[model samples]
Target: MSDDPNRIKALGGGSLLIAWQLKDKNVLIVGGGEVASQRVESILTADAHITVLAPASGLHPRTKLFIELRGDRVTHRDRQFEGPSELDGMDMILTALDDNELSNAIVKMSRERRIPVNAADIPDLCDFYFGAQIRDGPLQIMISTNGNGPRMASIIKKRLQAGLSGLEGQAITKVGLLRNKLKQRAPGVGGLLGRERMKWMSQLCNQWEMEDFSSLDDSAMENVLDKGWERGKRVPKPSELGISRRSTTSKSFSTTSLLLPSIAFFTGAVTATLLLSYSGRR
Candidate 1:
């Protein structure tokens, strides 16, 4: 958490970043305005069972669309949220009402019930902030200034998006497939502990070019992975691979490291072009 006043005001101080698994959990949402609608979009991706309590008259268009699209996954209660009783059996609660008093009341009730609550635009009242994110298939990068600078986070996300290429996503998928296969082939293995496994995977990534993997057909890809697995099995210890135990435990490869140099060059080009244009205007 950042101590910057703006970030603290946006996200609150002492907030820990975490990914919640909301699949099939009941989430209670109070209000049906645009803010609530935005919350709905965020949670819906997690497959949470949602109940929105808001008057039937003033539902935001996006909220209405969510109800329509989600159908049985979402239930709409055509009434105002009265009190804490609504928090019963909910895994999480979100309040997006225009009334600060009502939002504060709900937050207090949620506290008493021990349910996590997020009050839209009220960092002090929220348990967590919806930080900016960039998704590349199964790989996701989340940026937060502890709620201080969301606009800055968004700008960074765009820069990263421009810098990264789709090849990295394919590489992640390939790596995941290889890991699963290795785990299945050598279950409860001694040599392939966390650190050793990471070392082997890192070496595999270093040895195999992304272009080579991309050019391969499904069968060829499997052959390449199988050959890598065989080589990994032969190196029973990290020492055999010339990687000391300390080195293996100290460092880990990041998937983002797979981004091609060409992609980075392009990103730099784009940034330079923008700077040059601004300088000309000045």
Candidate 2:
């Protein structure tokens, strides 16, 4: 393990930071204790198809309740994890067992199968961590300290949540509706390209003052969106709107005005559409 707090190199020495969409994906979880319950709760919102391999009698009450509430979304094998065979078709594996030997064994098995695995409280054996997350409807902010300082991540997430307004969520919803409407009404508009759309959306979010959606009723919001789209159609270059193309193309855009409304609305809608497309897979 490296001494650097921001980096966690797993057993096979691979390091990468990524967000996996587990919707309708097969996930195998070992153990039924408190830690496992916590992992389950964290991923429940992801809509993953989960199967737990643990002794039925040893399952935690909370875990049982979660399975019951979710109905068919989750299933239990009612037996202890045997070996790598349980991971044959799994997209990912998670272990929350106190037994280090068993967890290590599972990690080894997962590695041989090229499956990503997360071992609770065992950063050295984990491929990823369930970092703190702040979700406001279609808006989501994830805070990660690599595999260290989870408590600090939670604290920062809370602080961010405190500074965020509920109207931001409503703004995201409104923007999403407007984007969909625009796509339907003007499918061939050049302003709808990735970079152009981002530039225009960012400008619109700033111009409309997305901090409060209550200020604009449905009609007013539509009118604003119409005007923004008109501006987008007219502005051949981002400089025309006082925005640089580099700003729109950067990996992380500036959050000076409305705080990620443009990027969040675009990415969130794509994610939602993908989830809906995969919903029927399982």
Candidate 3:
């Protein structure tokens, strides 16, 4: 295990990103403020049927799909939301209420009902954390800090926005091109090799400094895949792809090498002390 404290702490944290398929699924949003407006767009990205519960009805353009329920009185009975029992079958729930107590209560209820929930700005009450996401054709880039600091996540996402502008469509097209070529080269074995190659190319593409993604050439991509495959076969997980066992062993040896000099100095000091004591006694 790595000695990084953030990595350990973030293990228990919610997913930094999610690819949800909410098409034809019911989704409920508790508040109709700007936050709710933003969440509505995200859910609608999956083509979900959404319902909003708020006192008055005013909506952003993106929230047009959802049906709105109005009223100030708490009409909920039987511990069930009165507006729609349809919401009970919803695969996901999002709450953006100003009332902390109400948000907390709804989050607790959602958990008991086994529905995934996201309470805006409240990581402790949420089952998932939504990150800054940018959609480019078939590729989706998600940047997150596990809710430790959303601002930092957003900043990184913006930086990525400029870096990854036209890369996604290009990458997907390249993958398709690569796969088709592989079908002729190795047939059944092509898919496995194609996937490994695709992964390497994607990583290299992401590291590009400029919006000009002309650097994703086939030869270079293949070299990375070949190296990655050799390295990957010896590792247990994909995250450890670039890490080398030899480098780690070398660092450990260096640490041990430093201690030898200290040990020799300490031994010399002790011997000198012993000689001085014997001469004084004589």
User: Best by lDDT, which number?
Assistant: 1
Residue range 1-282, candidate 3, lDDT tens digits:
998999887786356455777777877888776888788767766777666766554444444333333212112111223433535776788888778887888887788889999999787888887878888766777787865687898889878776543545665766555445434443455376667655654564455322223234676444434454446522123233332222233455777999999999999999999999999999
Ranking of models by lDDT: 1, 2, 3
lDDT per residue as tens, model 1, 63-87: 9999998887899999988767888
Clashing pairs in 1: 6-148, 7-148, 11-147
Error of 1 at 156 (Å): 1.9
What is the model-wide C-alpha lDDT for candidate 3?
0.62
Give TM-scores for every candidate, taking all chains together and pairing residue i with residue i: 0.71, 0.70, 0.53
- The 0-to-1 C-alpha lDDT of every candidate, in the order given, reads 0.75, 0.73, 0.62
Off by over 4 Å in 3: 1-18, 55-86, 177-282
What candidate 2 gets wrong by more than 4 Å, as runs, is: 1-16, 189-198, 214-221, 226-282
Backbone clash total for model 2 is: 0
lDDT, candidate 1, equals 0.75
Cα lDDT tens digits, model 2, 50-84, are 88778989999999998888867888889988766
Between prediction 1 and prediction 3, which has the larger lDDT?
1
Q: What would the TM-score be for candidate 1 when compared with the true structure?
A: 0.71
Model 3 lDDT, residue 95, Cα: 86
lDDT score, residue 244, model 3?
25
Candidate 2: residue 73 Cα off by (Å): 0.9
